[model samples]
Target: MTSDALRVAAVDLGTNSFHMVIIEECREKGIVEIDRVKDMICIGRGSISTKMLDEKAMQSGIVALRNFLVLASQHGVAREHVIAFATSAIREAKNQDEFIRRVKDETGLKVKVISGKEEAEFIYYGVRNAVKLGSSCDLIFDIGGGSVEFVIADSHGVKLLESRKIGVARMFERFVLNDPISEHEIKLLEQFFAAELVSAAEKAVELGVKRGIASSGTAENIARMIRSLQGVESDVSLNNSIFTRREFNRLYRMVLPLRSSERRRMTGLDEKRVDLIVPGLILFDTIFRTFGLEEIVLSDSALREGMVLHYLQQHYDAGQNSDAPDIRRESVYELGFRCNWNRDHSEHVAMLCLQFFDQLIALHGLEQRYRELLEYAALLHNIGTFVSISSHHKHSQYIIMNGDLRGFSPSEKEIIGHVARYHRKSPPSEKHVQYSQLKQRDRNAVDVLSGILRIANGLERGHRQNIRELRLACNPDMITIGLRSHHEPDIEIWAAELLKSWLEAVLHRTIVFEPLHDA
Candidate 1:
């Protein structure tokens, strides 16, 4: 679609409600929110018990979707341009297939069920796009109908993403029994939330995250309430009227004792959200206490906004490169510097490893990312010798896994850790924790990269820079690795023998190491 003619719409099939936003994308004027709709279906209310969407709840959602489809069509939104996603409730429901089929039949819109990790990614995109919070580290919280997603990301990328079962609708249905919410019940809920918050907070700290951004209806409502109390226009920017922990706690305490009816009478609390206001407040307060956040800027956008941005970035702007640098390399380089490894030799080993990887890419089918990881593994393979000589590979694995790597995802870190672990030992196995944590694809990548690193490390064993050049020739039966060096064949032979076993185990075939006397 042309930039000016492009019209995009997003539907968030939330647990408590179905929400949609239609935006007209004008290149010169920027994006304009032209139409918005919300239908409170409470899909999570019935999903908790049967692990299946109740028939009545399914009908409620279908009706809402049909109405939305009509509205979208009226607004000139093409069926192909509209993106619809279902979150926690529908994703967890056992009979979601029937519900989705019915929705598709009635509304003509395909519903995409997103996992919690994907949900967190979209939320990050939304908050990052909507707000100009200058903080490098941000903790984003989205309290939805059935689940709460917490993400830690920065200009670099997502560091940690987690989702929990505590949400506004669930909290109210499971906890608040009294109209005003009795003090006894309040205490019990507070204790329960506190425990969860504490664990989440610890994990966030461990991941080196700071600052905070609140997203979704619950957080936005709190921001509106705070704004109304302060008598300010809600521009929804971080600078003007963000809430400090002290002020947030004061508001939480004030709202805690009020009845549901009384809460509706409050300036910022929406009438429909009265019953959930108490639980939402408790969630906010618990997070504040757990993280010890001084203040948090409220974001007007959440998962739906993020999803639209992601789709646009992926399809419309194909030239944009968002992948961060290789975190593993940075970590290894830093560790090597700290351990006082010979920089010349370390870099030489890494360069040779990458050279080997590039020459064998067609045969191995490994991606460019794996080559980068192998470079990193080679650089820090000898770092463990700083502590001791025996089983330095084990020490290196622990260090790489625990160290802070800026550009790597949790999955990438697992692969890097395994590659370093297997540099001088047997190939990665199920018994290895780091290897086990990785998905199958990543595990395979680690195995191939580790195999290459093992050979590179062996070739450099002389530590005197004896080997000059190497060539790799591969076939279905075996890999013929030829080394060109100026020195005697004794050192190269010993190293080649050590690498042969690892190469064979990884490729499940024989490996022949050949040494060339002269160029």
Candidate 2:
């Protein structure tokens, strides 16, 4: 929403769903998600065998896009900025042109039907950013409703890119005949998949692979169901979360023989994907057995994320900023950029925070893990100012709570939010319901990390980045911190002296701030 930010929407018209992902390209900050909406219109339903668009499904698809444009407008995505791509189902359908024409006439959006190879490449671009997929050999594959695209590659670059017409929807229409799908059907489906994926499998073996990365709704559904069985919290992210062969086998066994009704009641199974999951299971199991992958990493990004990246690459020079090494850091940086944060001051505070965390480790007794949480919290401590400077700390906590930060587990994100929440105002208290919801260990993390952030923020008073170095000395009863600054340290010393009390209480020591004049 900044003056320089260009908000755009990418619409993926897949066989089973109509999804629109809206993002803003914020210069060096990279792509930040603005909003996304999806409608499971199943536009490709019955089109696999008929080789034409279904009238009802096409009508529903138009409605979905019409509504998507409204959402894009709400998010400030102009018509010219919206790009819609139809894959697999539409690409092969005879009436694809009619559907595209109706959509454009009604919604003012042009639909580009992309080929299978193009889809695979776009997916590669998408998953690479999310999963850090620059390995010596990383196999990226996405199983869509109508086709599954496979890409075999390594750090050097892509080795093989292919697509097959064995998607879950196609298999479901062709193979699924019974509720609780019989043993005979399972064997037949596996045989078919074995034949279809033979080439991709052979290449996967020839090239050798470090890991398999699965991106698509089917993969995410499976990961979630498995995690549900393992009792993972619902808020925890499935992005880059892994499941071993054993885990997949366990889920398959539970799902394979279940009736449609039974599967519908299952935990973590999306109601929309209940029927498709049967064939989905067979396809995924076949891929696993075919490729000899011990484990697969789940990516939240797929074609939708790829579309954003591809668009950014074409329009803006966006790709892999070394400054933000991982998705977690990049995601955090994007959120900070969206809020138009004072990067110099936030980075300075974060720098000071990490320094304090290392120097005070003995007193704090916190593990190295807390160091990351502290740093992210410091970087985002002022983002609430995006909403309004008034009680911006509260707004900051709210924003961080719902920012949907990728690559961070729910607990880690919660800890970061709580730390940022307490950066300015009162410390964590029992009366604050959100703070009280945390576990004992997490509450302690918030307390200590926020305490560090408070002093760091205080030292950077006036956003001057004056404090260059910190020297700490511990005594039996009191601790003294020496500050070295390029300018006079009167304000920083005065501000930190006031903010050090919360940290003193947390560390159970009296604290003193002294300005050091070094020759």
Candidate 3:
């Protein structure tokens, strides 16, 4: 019994259906679900043949949108607070522009067509907010109407985000034939799913992920089936339910031989989902077989919930300050400590690196996050020494790649790991997996910032607080680094020779390192 005040709404214009959720945010009672609406418009059904939405589909979609708009208006949701997004159906349709324009004209809702990656990210954010996951790594599988988005990440950040073109509705339309699907057609569907699952599993392996959890309609059905077969009460909650692989296989085998009517007659089968249930089972069975996952935890929340949580986190929670240690700085400091790196030397080098980063920010168009990453790389340039004194650069790469660094996204971690790898022995090259993952913009930032870190690390090689200051002068073709220190020139020369090659390769310019003496 909570007062319904301060409502927020999220609308999902999905490929198979239109869904809307209205939540009342209450401080004492937490989020109270006020209203929800769902309509199976099957927008993708129109685009499958013509690669554009058909007139009938457009009309159906309009009806659903109009209904959703009325619900939002009734709840007094503001235009700015109501977020709407469309998926594969809109993204793949040739007539998307007209459809979007018409929808906006009629319903006054602006729809954002998001990419698969963004979709996966939103889903992950949503699950993290709603589900209480144990310490084990989580792989979120979202099976929608036209596509399945898989995301693997821990509490740290997203490690893998990939999408495949297989969903319950799409699979049914493509392969599930016969009233109850025939054995021959079920086998065919299984083969097709098995192939796709193998490829996706291979990709997941490359990213070092093993566990998985289900996030959407198909998963909910599986949970429902489990509950019914166990003779659990219809009113039993799904919050603590779990489905084992063997049980899923049993359900799969049982459903594959049944006709659409037979499936409808089965317990816990929703009438609206009867046509798509066989293919959905096939998809799930294939995924479980391919990954060898023992069991899957079902999450009631998926994309819509994820979208709402993400919006709230970005707009509300992000503004509040917390006392947690800055993850970026902590990661950098830990890297140095693990390497047994000279603290005085690493800090001195980092100072010079930051100075260089600030000097060329305009030319590089680097963001503040990149600057933080650059500082991290500069501090940990010598992390490889802990493994072996020689070829420590390779060791540094291995450690950074494997170690869990909090507060860094997968992309940020890849950049920092690559930058650390390139500190001593090599320049950025496409041959390296981590380096190749960086976007063009980030690659350029890593290149310039890594150059600065290399030179700084070289300058502080004496390991005795010898280098007091560095004076940098940059010209069109060559940059000069002047080291002011009382240390022997031999120590400076040894470090400078290594710096020269790395600087030349990174900047494509000649570098001269010199030690200065007072007059």
Please tell me which predicted candidate would have the highest lDDT against the true structure: 2
CA lDDT scores, all candidates in order: 0.75, 0.87, 0.73
lDDT of 2: 0.87
What tens-digit string does per-residue lDDT give for candidate 2 at 426-487? 98899999789899998988889999999999999878989999999997788898999998
Clashing pairs in 3: 179-260, 180-258, 180-259
TM-score of 2: 0.81
Candidate 3, after superposition: displacement of residue 156 in Å?
1.2
lDDT of 1 by residue, 1-519 (tens): 344556778999999889999876543323446688998888877576668888888888899888888898898888898999999899999988988899988888899999988898888776665554343667888899888998887667777788888878877878878878998878877887877676668777786655678887777778778877778655433222368887777788788888777788888677778888788888887787677778887676678767776777788862112743232344356567656567777777787788778887787788787887787777777777777779988877776665544335445556777888888767888886657867888888887888888877787887766777878788888878777777875686688687868667767768887877752
Where does the lowest 10-residue lDDT sum fall in candidate 3?
318-327
* Cα error of candidate 1 at position 513, Å: 78
lDDT over C-alpha atoms for residue 85 of model 1: 96
Q: Give the alpha carbon lDDT tens digit for every residue of 1-519 in model 3.
A: 235346778888887888899866644324446788889888988475567887898889988888887888788777778889889778888999999999999988899998988888778766554454444556778888888888776656666787777777778878865787787887888898777667568766775555677877667877788768878654443532468888888888787777777788877776778887778888888787777788887665678877886776677763112222243465456556545677777777787778767765544567887887877776776677888879887777667655544345446666777777777776888887767867889888778777777766676677666767666677778767677777665675588577767657766668787788878
Estimate the lDDT of model 3. Answer: 0.73
Residue 244, model 3, lDDT? 89
Span of 10 residues, lowest total lDDT, candidate 2: 316-325
2 versus 3: better TM-score goes to: 2
